[model samples]
Target: MTIDAKRIVVLVPARNEEHSVADVVLEVSAALPGATVVVIDDGSTDRTADEARRAGAVVLSMPFNVGIGGAMQTGFIYARERGFRAAVQVDGDGQHVPSEIPRLIECLEEGADMVIGARFLGRGDYRAPLLRRLGMHLFSAALTVLTRRSFHDTTSGFRATGRRGIEFFARTYPSDYPEPEAILLLCRAGYDVREVPARIRERESGASSITFFRSIYYMIKVLLAIAMGMTRRAPVRRRGEER
Candidate 1:
């Protein structure tokens, strides 16, 4: 079960993404040569697991569809357990471009525990709906006020994490609406989280998992989660005491 720690691994969390998983895997593999790509097929009823494997990725199929947060946590656990030095979270929906992975990794190598490939930091082709854009701004402002750090996109899932970040999330990751909450968790634990501008391609196939109706609920849940996170204390781990 020994894997190369020198190579940065790309972790893809997928659910019923039969149409796009293979392409994502191949692009990731090509984009980061020698880097291992693993797919967490989150209880997909389609051929996601098989397609990913056929595309030359190590696939871990979940028995049930945990939300995106849970699936990502699983990937972190896998990466940490295998002694990977770092991991990049790439979506199976094809929105996250593989070519931009190195930029995220560069930031990670420059001493950031977490590097978020932010969509709104610089000009990009990504254009969320007006309502979604407003919600993003609200979350960003709230996070900035609470954390004392500027946050442009609190909901972007495209990110990379160093070993410390991976281990931290492996131990205590949020299961629901994790992106925004994760920033708070890492900052509380004394980890450096940075953001780099990256572009996102609109999905050409399949509907997004989050619907318009669910987005309202998602916003409310995330805000409450962030508020609760502020009051809580992050557990500090002693050196060599990792579980």
Candidate 2:
């Protein structure tokens, strides 16, 4: 399929990534010219919104500071309303590379409901923090048990989902610290998930929301969310497809 017919959109949910958002947006836009790009500015106190818009993305600014989950859910809503065939979540912090987008687009074309960029599939160049890696491993294991399928990179933000996945997330998605548990949520809704090989860069600037104190808090919160998503599951039935 040509890029225009695919209706693929790149969703960038940014908080305070003012320094990186501009360059990232421009690069993604150039990489996928036919694809529409939307940047959700989640109430950043800096020039995130202005800079993102100037960089040539369709900017959506939230009135209040919602978390990453909220910002991404908003992007899902946009895709749903705009009749986009697929939506790919890209980090505005310059971690995810734009050149790898075609592989994700190919995944959607190949009939997978969701495709995640696995940083550890064959490369560990991202060099995630030790504690974060532990958290990801633990969550990946727990989610594998819950989903009854192999999911290596549960915390990977580089994910592409089709219209069904977009619609599902528009109605329900993670609120805070949503990386790992969000996969469980997608599985309970009956979407088939796959992981792809991709590399990520370290953050160029700014600070992560997951500080030492918040890391502990996030681990507990995500654990609770995983358990809750498993119990409170309802399949989205589309002509008995269960996807």
Candidate 3:
């Protein structure tokens, strides 16, 4: 399963990350030479789009700020429309290491529809705040139960998706708190979703959008979203079928 580098697209979804987006683009280009890197500028008032283009990345500037889910779906749609065989997600804030991307791609090559770069897998010394950590644990537990499989890091945004995953996600991606919900969605849809250890660093600039009270709000809202998702039947898909 040796995929051509030209057929792979690295999707970097960013918002107001002008300070670090260029560096991230450069690193992704260097790490995966010949792979197409597209940065989705989520309506940043700053110079995010300009910085990304200057760094040799294809920039997709949104009309306004669509959150992470909308930004990422735009990337997947681009990948699908352009007939990319695989899509890799790297945050624009430079928290995700480009060098570790190969690990996730390897899992995809090994037949995983999607591969998550798990931070708690002992490969990195990354630590989250107390409330955030608890929320992660809750989401992980709920996903494990819902999917009947183990999930170590449900909130990690670092991930890679093969063709099947790209097509599915392009059509049906959650709009809010998508990381954890996406795992359950793919798993329930009968996709091979796996996780691998990867290193994640602190963001180079800007603070997290999830603040103290926001964390609590995020937890409740996401749990409700997950519950609603569980009530619906997963879409039927024929394995290996292309849309």
Candidate 4:
């Protein structure tokens, strides 16, 4: 019997994304065949789970509404339990193009611990709102300072994680505003990262949850969490660790 060393999985953390859930899952399955696609349905009021299951992806439906961070941590735990070597964290929104997923795998195979799809890195006509872009840059600057590394995109949800990254976040991950906080956590954990050019499409349907007021507070709160996480160290004893 032979086993494959290169096991890749795509994780979609979704909530009330019935409009976009099926397409996202089907597209990923089409792009990367022979790999499992798991969609963590985060207590969607709509038909997100049904649509995802119909699209041929395994759906892990949360009993209650957990934020994106919790959904993502669930994916990490599944990956650890399943012994998957590489996993890609993709949003349920249609914004992330499934065609670009392989690039992240290539980044990991090429020896990078983490790869983030940067919209500014030779991208096409990106349509992110002006205010969001401004906040994105500000958070990027703050994260670089906190992690002591150079990173242009902190809030971009398009990213890939290797074995090291999967195990790291499964143990300790942020509760809110995790897309950026994960970057700081990974950097502080001594993981090497690479940013590559990728063309992301605009959201096809469903309104984004980020409002102007929440975006402001999200920026501040995430920045503070990352700063503190960077400075703190894990206790010598983990939950299941034997002393």
Candidate 5:
């Protein structure tokens, strides 16, 4: 079953990415014609919002920097409220290839509640720094054990979700380090989450948000969040199963 492009929304969460946000918006528009491109400007001091608007994207400007997690939740909330059937997350820095969005949507159509665009799935030559690679491997292993399912790129931000995922995340999403935590949340709730190979490019401009010290902090905080999440009861029962 081919989903209509009009029922999909491409969400771009940007912070201080004035130089590349416009181009990213344009690229997404071209890649997925007829889809709504909404840019969640996470309190960027630069002209990120203006650039996105000028590039023909709907802009949601936050009052202040709410981090990636908050920005993404805002997009999901919008998707849920606006009645979009599916939503795709494309980063503002141009790392994610908008052209690959259809692959994710295909997974959603195939009964996946959420689809992650994994970078290290043997499809791309994209390489992370040594420290970041180690973190990814560690998170993948931890999530594999906790969820009883394999995960390769737990830290990947490129993703897409169907209506079920959109509604669930809108209601309850983590505030920090949400990517990995979100996987656990969905699995515990018995949602089908899958990963697909995707090629990623280096950021078009600006430095990465994860600095050396912040990487350490991110790892520690996310692990703690996962541990706490494990003890909490599943927010929703498995799909198509009795309560």
Candidate 6:
């Protein structure tokens, strides 16, 4: 299925990813020539914004580091404001393959409110370490129970969403560890969520924010957020409202 590039936006959220952002932005532009590429520079002390801009991507620099969730929500707000029909999110760390973005958009075109590009769903060389894999499994199980849906890779950040999902998230998004919880949020809000197999590469540079201790904290914090989300009411979509 072919989609109008003008109707789609590739949102790259970066922080101190100067080494990798340029290549990622270039690859995304090559993969989808006409799509708008926007890099949310999450207050990087490095030259992330400069590299992204040089690579032909529109840069939105945050005043301070707002983490992944805040950066992504800012991108969604941009998409909504610009009247984009769809939005695809790929990490700026060079882990997610830009070429696979089409596969995610295909699912979205087929009627999925949101499509997750899952790493563990198929045979591949990208493997998380034992401890990290265990943490992922625990969260995947928790999401499955909460949403009553099978989820193989809840932590996958490679995802695409249609207008409704983008608009909904722009209004209210989780602050920390938003990927898995965002999926559950869409499901509870009556949106169709789907997943497909995709590949991941090792980061080109820089250390991961998730450490042995931080991964544990991430699990606890995300789980609590998901539980709280279940009890809260989703906002009603108001028509004729400006994005």
Clashes of each: 0, 0, 0, 0, 0, 0
Compute the lDDT of residue 218 as modeled in candidate 2: 82
In terms of lDDT, the poorest run of 10 residues in model 6 is: 234-243
lDDT of 5 by residue, 1-243 (tens): 677999999999999999999999999999999999999999999999999999999999999999899989999989988999999999999999999999999999998999999999988899888988888998999999999999999999999999999888888788877899999999999999999999999899999999999899999998899999899987774333211
Please write out the lDDT profile of model 3 over residues 97-181, one tens digit for every residue: 9999888888899999999999999998999999999999999999998889999999999999999999898888888779998
Alpha-carbon runs more than 4 Å astray in model 2 = 1-6, 237-243
TM-scores, each model vs. reference: 0.94, 0.93, 0.96, 0.92, 0.96, 0.95
- Per-residue CA lDDT of model 2 for 1-243, tens digit only, reads 433534988999998899999998998988888788899999999999999999888999999998898889899989999999889999989888888888887887888788899999886477778888888888989998988998888888998888788888887778888777667777787778888998887877777778877887888899988887778746554434211
Local accuracy of candidate 4 as per-residue lDDT tens digits, 113-172: 789998887776786788888888888888777766778877888888888888887887
RMSD of 5: 3.1
Off by over 4 Å in 1: 1-6, 238-243
lDDT by residue for model 6 (71-161), tens: 9999999999999989999999999999999989998889999999999888357888787899889888988898888999999999999
- Per-residue accuracy of model 1 over 1-243 as CA lDDT, tens digit each: 232435677999999999999999999988888999999999999999999999999998889988888888888889888888889999998999999988888888788999999998774778988778888898899888988888899899999999899889888788877899899888878888888999999885788777787889888998999889888776575444333
Model 6 clash count equals 0
Candidate ranking (TM-score, best to worst): 3, 5, 6, 1, 2, 4
Query: How does each model score on lDDT?
Result: 0.87, 0.84, 0.92, 0.82, 0.92, 0.89
Would you list the clashing residue pairs of candidate 1?
A: none
How do the candidates rank by lDDT, highest first? Answer: 3, 5, 6, 1, 2, 4
How good is model 2 by TM-score? Answer: 0.93
Worst 10 residues of 5 by lDDT: 234-243
Off by over 4 Å in 5: 237-243
